[model samples]
Target: MSFRNLAAAFALTCVAVPALAQTPAPATTAHSASDMGLKMADTATVKLKFVTVKPADITSSKLIGTNVYNNNKETVGEIEDLVIENGKTVTGVIVSVGGFLGLGERYVVLDPSTISVSNKDNKWAAYVDTDKDTLNKAPTFDYSKKK
Candidate 1:
């Protein structure tokens, strides 16, 4: 009985001693947006204004990638992107010109008012008053240098 009791005590010591001796893993920390070096903008700082869209109002989805044409119905460029200032006004429209299958493509920023868009027969088209040659020779807009 004494030997049996000693053996039981030995078993408990062998199991508990190793467990007590082992160091616990470090606590996992929950990372917030700030911790990852991202500064989140406060939505409360921006005043929200509700806007009502009319049926004639064009959506961005329909405007972007729309083929641009001249008054002669010649293809001048394609609308690539839009530049918005203060999240309110669209300042410029980015048009890709002089590209052959996107190989020699160059971007040009045009005034929003200069380009007119129309949706006739469910086909969206943008018209600019410039020719294809003029747009191809215009000053290029480099996307890599955008701040």
Candidate 2:
């Protein structure tokens, strides 16, 4: 064969070999239980149960925005955020205190255990053992600064 023809054949072979060696992906279709020889259980076999909680139980949404009071029955601040540990338990709460209309407000971190909830005058009240003065002086928690 001529050198030019041989080189042309070799280049075509190299390009076509890789394209011919590739296997096409298998086509997929929507499947049902019967398609795999599986049977669906009867509705009667399924049981639905409702989770019950006491009225005093504190939910995450309820905990947030709830007013936090001190031992002196003074409003310290409201809960701005909750710190959950391992997605199961609450470890602490971020309290917004010492600010007017959120201008000078600073967040303070306190343990969830240190707060208590009570039913007073048909309303849920949250109380922290520390006073506003102490909370205002506590170290501020910044959400922007993350570890």
Give the top-scoring candidate (TM-score): 1
Model 2 per-residue lDDT tens digits across residues 19-111? 333232236744333322112455433233223344434455555567888888888998766664432334567789988887798999898
In candidate 2, stretches whose alpha carbon ends up further than 4 angstroms from where it belongs are 1-50, 144-147
> What is the lDDT of every predicted structure here?
0.65, 0.61
Clashes, model 1: 0
- Candidate 1 at 13: error in angstroms? 74
Specify the highest-lDDT model's number.
1
| Candidate 1 segments exceeding 4 Å error | 1-40, 46-49, 144-147
What would you estimate as the lDDT of candidate 1? 0.65
Please write out the lDDT profile of model 1 over residues 1-147, one tens digit for every residue: 343333332332222332333233247844333322112366544233223344655556676679999999988888877665433346677888887887788999999879788889999999999888899889999864233
* TM-score for all models, in order of appearance: 0.66, 0.59
